[model samples]
Target chain A: MSGRVDIIGLGPGAEDLRCPRAAGALAQATDLVGYVPYLERVAEDSGQRIHGSDNREEIQRARLALDLAIQGRRVAVVSSGDGGVFGMAAAVFEAMEQGDPRWRALEVAVHPGVSAVLAAAARLGAPFGNDFCVLSLSDNLKPWGVILNRLEAAACAGFAMAFYNPISKARPWQLGEALARLRRHLPGSVPVIFARAVSRPEEHVEITTLADARPEQADMRTLVMVGNAETRLIPRPGGEPWVYTPRRVGMNA
Target chain B: MSGRVDIIGLGPGAEDLRCPRAAGALAQATDLVGYVPYLERVAEDSGQRIHGSDNREEIQRARLALDLAIQGRRVAVVSSGDGGVFGMAAAVFEAMEQGDPRWRALEVAVHPGVSAVLAAAARLGAPFGNDFCVLSLSDNLKPWGVILNRLEAAACAGFAMAFYNPISKARPWQLGEALARLRRHLPGSVPVIFARAVSRPEEHVEITTLADARPEQADMRTLVMVGNAETRLIPRPGGEPWVYTPRRVGMNA
Candidate 1:
């Protein structure tokens, strides 16, 4: 118990996906704290009890991670995907403001890895080639009204969007609600790329229209990217698909 | 050579920066084609003379790469950043569209990489937590009018902006012009983060304001990320400066 708190990124799940920097930090950690699913992503023998918590207990888990850091533990907070992207990095900072004398001495570092949004966008080529937003449809953290307001604003701005935590087993109807709102501004034929368990063993990317997207097709592992009106899907040789956002400023068409 | 031309993403600069799948593609490449600056980034010996091109010869060089691919070279038209973000991948497609019929028959895939934009944004504590756009100020192929239109749109929409190729030796005042235009809509004190040579030998980041940023402070190697109305500069305990874009929706405070 003589090291700073290191918030490590587990990349997109696979061990090979771990950034060298994230791996190095995890190797040096004595304690790992996160949700059970995220904690399971780290393979190292943590030598400390896994601090698992339900989603509502994130505040408590964050506080415990910081307290251990204050006690000079080589604490590792495991966040799947990049630590900063809808992950645990901000929660750690949220709990850091607690006025503890020992906490003041703790060093905190956020090692970034690939975000699933970017990974999903990549699989669908240029789905995010222009203005974009990453929004969570879950109402657990914020009021649904606020989500609707931001969704409307984002849609009016005409940015390609990636939805995170879009559909869960209990929240089947929220995705439909969000997509219904998207239909108000976005065209019905806007290409939506839904990638499940990206960069993991059971990874698959499905392409469909926004109007045709179904919650039955998605799960917690799915990352959905919806293209802007300018995005084009063109067929290529041998069943390989190609999608592109038209060059906005420079190309001679 | 009965192979195709593929724009492989080597990820960021480091071998570890590469995606597992992208790394697999690079290992299978028989020919590597890119500018001298980017060609040097490829680690493996593909046994093909690297297609070196001057800065002004990008169009011709891409056309040449397409020609070689038409002759059935398993050519990997390499680019430093994510191929779609101001990289040569777009140019290769342009060249292909205007090339010989045989060239159009070959398959082309644009594998995404961890762009300098993503890398720099991560270092800055996720200034892109909200809506954002990445645009280049380099007027080589784009008209100033078009560039200004997008800048105006982004600024008016209050979008966080990441600028690539903001300025070079010959284009020293481009940033000043961009700043002047951007400042007209944004507040004079909006925070600007200049990440120079990110993840490279001379890597460093500097924080400045709209009215205070000097043109000489940046060159083409730099990435300028200007935060939006909600971004805050927090003096963290680690003394590594941090900027955060508020999640905009959930302000329980």
Candidate 2:
């Protein structure tokens, strides 16, 4: 807690695509801090890896990492996409604020990464055409009423949407409920694009009608994109557009 | 072109963040293609850079890039963020289809990058919380009516929105029109975020009410986020929390 916390952004999944800064940070670190899955993503484990786990364990792991760093160990806490953006950096800052004085005094810096939202958006041409807001479906901390209000607002606004933590182990039906609500406001033919495991293994994208998408299509790693009416599934007849979205909105209508 | 055509991505703005594969693709390119500013942002220039002076020139540059690649030269057409999101990759494809059949059979691979929309979204939390849409307010190629219709539909649906290419040198008042339209359906206090020059030298972020944001606050490089009513800006004494609109339809909200 005595030393600074350097939260490194390894960018997206591929090592060939990893930032040199993040790689250097890890190589120089005496300890690493991050969720277990993220650690598993990085195979070249040289430093003392901080075994952080599930949602509640981040604070404890961050404290331990800060404590180790306070003992003069170079520490690097990892996040899959960007260090910021609903990632560990937010929790790290929270811990530093609520924890010991030594931790508070430490200098912290966040390196930006290629967030999956941006990655998924790029896969689809101009998915975010104008004004759009992103909200997580996980109710673990947020209330559903608040989530529904925002979803309604977003649907009403017709912004290209990117959904994260959409379908989870326990929260299987949240995304479905969201779709049903959106259907009430938006034309059912809106192109809803699902980019599964973007930038990693099992990377796949599906352009389907908002009503046609099944919950099984999405998993923890999947990044779902529900396109606006203008976005169309450009079916390539013989060879499908690597990306798909119906060209016309409300074709189902 | 005897060599393969690699459409590389320059992740955001920093050099260290450049995907190693993207960098490698650029290094092997005999000719590089992109808009002027994008080319300048890339770290190293190993090949002849084909900078497009105008939008129409994008096709010309793509043609040259394809021609160079077809002539047995390694060609890498560059895009500032991701090559696919309003970048050269699409133009390159378009050019290939239009080119003489003798030259159309060459291999082309598009490498992805961190797109600006996602970077902006990550900075603002999940702006795509529910259903949303993105639009470029620039009237260069698209008519104002087209943009207006999308905006109208989006407003009625209550989608969070992200506005790119909002203000330019000539069309200074376009954003004002958008703001005015949004105000009709949205509360004046709705969060309107401005992400200026993201990941660039003069990068800055601000969250203001829809009506409070002055036209002078934006530029060509700025990304404007007008959140749905559900999108609330948590104001810190001097700083604003990057807004995240939680969906309120289910228990999680």
In terms of TM-score, the best-performing candidate is 1
| lDDT for each candidate structure | 0.71, 0.67
Per-residue alpha-carbon lDDT of candidate 1 for residues B35-140, written as tens digits (9 for 90 to 100): 7777777745856656767775656877887777777677777777576666766566556555665665676666656677777876776576555666778776
Query: What's model 2's TM-score?
Result: 0.75
For candidate 2, give the lDDT of residue B174.
90
Residue-pair clashes per candidate, as listed?
0, 69
The reply for model 2, stretches above 4 Å from the true place, is A55-74, A93-105, A120-135, A145-157, A181-193, A202-211, A233-240, A244-253, B1-5, B43-51, B55-74, B89-106, B117-135, B141-162, B177-212, B224-253
For all the predictions, what are the DockQ values?
0.32, 0.25
- Write one digit per residue (lDDT tens) for candidate 1, span A27-144: 7887888888787766458466677777647557778988887777888888777766677765665565444645645777777677787666555555655545667777776677
lDDT of 2 by residue, B46-131 (tens): 44545445543767887888777767877777877667655666566556555655444566667667666656765555554444
lDDT of 2: 0.67
Clashing pairs in 1: none
Candidate 2 chain B has its poorest 10 consecutive residues by lDDT at B244-253
